[model samples]
Target chain A: MKPSDKAPSEKALVPFVSVDHMMQLIHHIGVEEMMSGIAGYIEDDFHRWELFDKTPRVASHSEVGVIELMPTSDGEMYGFKYVNGHPKNTKEGLQTVTAFGLLANVETGYPMLLSEMTMLTALRTAATSAMVAKHLAPKGADTMAMIGNGAQSEFQTLAMKAICGLKSVRLYDIDLAATEKCAANLAAQDIKVVICKTPEEAIEGAQILTTCTADKQNATILSDNMVGSGVHINAIGGDCPGKTELAAGILQRSDIFVEYPPQTRIEGEIQQLPEDYPVTELWQVITGTAAGRTSERQITLFDSVGFAIEDFSALRYVRDQLEATGLYHALDLLADPDDPRDLFGMLQRAAPGNA
Target chain B: MKPSDKAPSEKALVPFVSVDHMMQLIHHIGVEEMMSGIAGYIEDDFHRWELFDKTPRVASHSEVGVIELMPTSDGEMYGFKYVNGHPKNTKEGLQTVTAFGLLANVETGYPMLLSEMTMLTALRTAATSAMVAKHLAPKGADTMAMIGNGAQSEFQTLAMKAICGLKSVRLYDIDLAATEKCAANLAAQDIKVVICKTPEEAIEGAQILTTCTADKQNATILSDNMVGSGVHINAIGGDCPGKTELAAGILQRSDIFVEYPPQTRIEGEIQQLPEDYPVTELWQVITGTAAGRTSERQITLFDSVGFAIEDFSALRYVRDQLEATGLYHALDLLADPDDPRDLFGMLQRAAPGNA
Candidate 1:
């Protein structure tokens, strides 16, 4: 065959992991193993967080929801995720969150991987929570009180079990159907599950509490009186301005740990508190620059607003694993001319069959 | 088939236009006709520019080049282009710029169209230049001196011919092979083509002068003595910082027009000019809020660094044409579960083949 009829040149193709491939990849490594692996990558990035470019995510807010582009680079590789959060979408049979990401070579400015990140985002968020829990959760913490059991419930449970050796989870949500779905999905896993009706009953004996709800308003999912001392709280639902979950009293009681102070101050649970509220950076704890969980009586809360570096690390991990698993399709995404300056000639040659 | 084994739901798919399909679509519509059509869309957008969400492109600069995300919305639809610029890439047989864009439903936050935009960017950039020229060029202008016969040279010439009724083009480049390739590509066009060795010889007797060199430095392709009165100059090559084509004397004498002043001040040819340098917004001219080409002896320079709104307009045009042409493939880019909050269940069901 002539060169024109041959498959696209290597430089013209970007490796794309579709939703199917992403699912296949998750299963290939096993869900628990994948969660553990992703946590390891997040930990490595956290140790070297100072090397990354850290800017607040660029967001465009609409009346109903918000769309954002989170970008970060490590000097060698660049990555970005295009994501949206519309909490009302689930009522219309659409996801409240959807995402896709790209990883490019910084030297050449050419994309190396493009992947469906809806599923990956769930996995990475869970991994990050579990990794942070490992560093801050109370000693011998095995049972997690997973309030607001929605799409992220099972993944969070599995990641906690895989990374922090959690043995059981108590789930509660305003909608019992969501809790039922979470329970049914985790039936085959190696952890015990408890379905509870009230938020107070869910955290009865658990030492770790993870709250991730889908409400766009500032309704209190966790009340101040419900949270006790010596338990680590992983708060993931309060991720945008004017959409927080924990009560202001709870934030005042707990020693908060955040990804980035600037972002957390605006979008995390601390948005309700003063702008200059003191919070410790998670990377500082990981890198041994700050103390973490100094005593069993101390109340520690990880205000988990996702960051760009976490996405960058997730993309980096996927890029490293893509070639080994072969669970990707090469997309003809770039236009490459024989002579880099002859794009017009390339179009001229493609004119024959079009007529 | 069982419901679990069925194909993905329609909401899970995004229409993707690959490089080959983009080429076919361009050929299906004649090149000049497509250029004119894009110019029409751009003109329409320029007239309604106040309705757009305008923001400076978010760029991550590396030592070698830069990667940028340009995003905009018209309240109903949102679009963004992922583009990279590495001038040193040409030596390695890669195009200096490669781009891809997605048009999304603003209400749903779901992508409706994903398209390869390397070729589309070329077409849109040329169409923008021509559209600007139609508003600012000398009356009855028929000839254009096309400096730097790179990937963008022929497209610019043809766009000028298609949109402004140009009759001929004079092409010159530091590399003769680029000029030869551009000349050969435009051989079948309706416009007269002239090849020249020197920039001075090429601009002779031309009413419109276009300069789009590829160097990263401020090398003056047109000296002070070269540019004359009443000629419309389309300056595109000097897009990034520290890159310029015309001498400062040329910019000092011309009535400069720019897409967005905030961006043009940092990345366009005006980067060399003072921070408070006066330049007209092109949209203002189109909207008749500002005057364009007031005097016959006045030299008008279009400082074209490109803008996110132009890409938004281009994506809107492609989205409008997508269904009619039927040249796109549906990509499984998003995860859509029957129950929006049952993502864990979806992963558990895809486990059969992974083992």
Candidate 2:
């Protein structure tokens, strides 16, 4: 028998969104609008959280970082993300985090969407943060203090503007160049961008404080003295075990809300506290089952550890918009033989020179 | 900001082998040779199984099927397979199992290979069976009794012929058409094929009995009365809970061998036995740390549920062969930026009209 390369069947082609295509889709919809769009999907899924298969993300941790598989289903559709986080990668001219995701049919288990999620993850993470802020921030909040301006700083600031109607963003990072890069990126956007020299100065007079430093340590990007009452804090940096950005004193003082308590307990700011530390589920707040910001003097904290359902929602949103935007390629990713049982026959018929 | 779909950088492209390409590659090497090749890799990895990170596959079970993520790493490289098993799918003109896999560098956590594993999985499963049979089968075993002639029947037989020097095969299935299909696929091969009407007839003079029926429930494909002494049983179909092939009495008499005892106990034929049932790990036997077939009357049953390390070995083999074959597409699956920290800049630079 000879060998031949055969073309994939129609059923084998999965709609794939590359990073460039994702950027095009985002720009076509506008980054801020896309962020708001993803937030809407997140909010919708959170409203019906009981229907989802809410298993924890499966992880493979090594000495340097962790690679995780986040999967979820809503009876009809299923989705999973393959994401890796290696903080040391940035020093080696690689992104600290890179991701790709897939959406499939629960009934058939055939993949419908294959997407590059490195950019989309940044988008969804920011969108989730701002969406939580909209629920927990004080009324008439307009300013946000963004500490540790990095890859996510600009997107987080824009998402807050788009979803929570934030007017001004103050950026602060120990690396001055990172702050400058973020400020330059947002210079042409609608909101005000202020490059602050210190985290203390960045939080002054701000109604919302977002901490997004990228270190795998327990460094305090925002200390107890830096936070004030009547403010919503979005902590996006401390997402893995042994990694936290805010001081422990601040957690003790604030009302903490988290996405899926089981995961957040292991990989969020609350990991510093006792296992039984009281925290509110953000889904309950979205569904009005739990209280949000109640008093002007109280500080509310959204411990934003990423979740599988959020990736599921993001994949769902991509699949829904892909056809309309025409921003994806058909990926030959699965096998579909005419006679499924005769898989061997299909291979034999694909012999070289037969075609 | 404008949007443009930029071509992925060389670093960002992952080599993708579709099912069609997988078949072509297999044909290029010859199916029997490919089977033996995969078996060799599986055997090598089995010998050093202690170096691998062994964990139970993460599964999401639906009413009709399951979607699973099987991940394993050898400190240097990481691999995982996304596979689904739906027993009723063949009735709907879909394969009962479909899969795709990814291999990545552990140092950088970046994907290096993305291949369609639907056909590769079939090849690897068969190779694994043959490799285990080489260690546990009766002395001078030349014939195999295959009870389920489904998609895996021909592959299994060919693999046995290539690796274990099998000279003849006896095939039996509840569906006559499946048996005919298996027989027809092996008609031109080097081995003699016999289509049997019943399980008892199939195992008449065979020294190895392999049961691979596709039933979801524990319907005994092989009972204690039919089995003879000194024969090895390769049980492949009983891969999930509530799914078993051999009778509990057969399990009681045979010396069970398994890949990853914790996983096999939950998803293999041993699920019918007590949790503390004595079983030897196949790796220990391959490494000469444990005993194999001891006497002419001893029955060795390999309870293979398939492990991540096997898939890892398969992925590694494909990656090594990819460059020589040129049987892959460069999938733009990862986002690579000129400045890793400036992912936003990459997206912004991709704005169509701006460029």
| Candidate achieving the largest lDDT | 1
| Regions of candidate 1 where Cα sits further than 4 Å from its true position | A353-355, B1-6, B353-355
Scoring each candidate complex against the real one, what DockQ results?
A: 0.85, 0.76
CAPRI category for model 1: high
RMSD of each: 1.6, 2.0
**lDDT tens digits, residues B146-204, model 2?**
99998898999999999999999999999999999989989999799999999999998
**TM-score between model 1 and native:** 0.98
Query: lDDT scores for all predictions?
Result: 0.91, 0.90
Q: What are the clashing pairs of model 2?
A: B2-B351, B2-B352, B3-B351, B3-B352, B4-B350, B4-B352
TM-scores of chain A in all candidate models: 0.97, 0.97
- Listed in order, each prediction's TM-score against the native is 0.98, 0.98
lDDT of 1: 0.91
lDDT of 1 at B88: 95
Candidate 1 structure quality by residue, lDDT tens digits, B29-76: 888898899889999988889888888999999888999999998888
Candidate 2 on A216-248: residue-level lDDT in tens?
A: 989888878878889999999999998999999
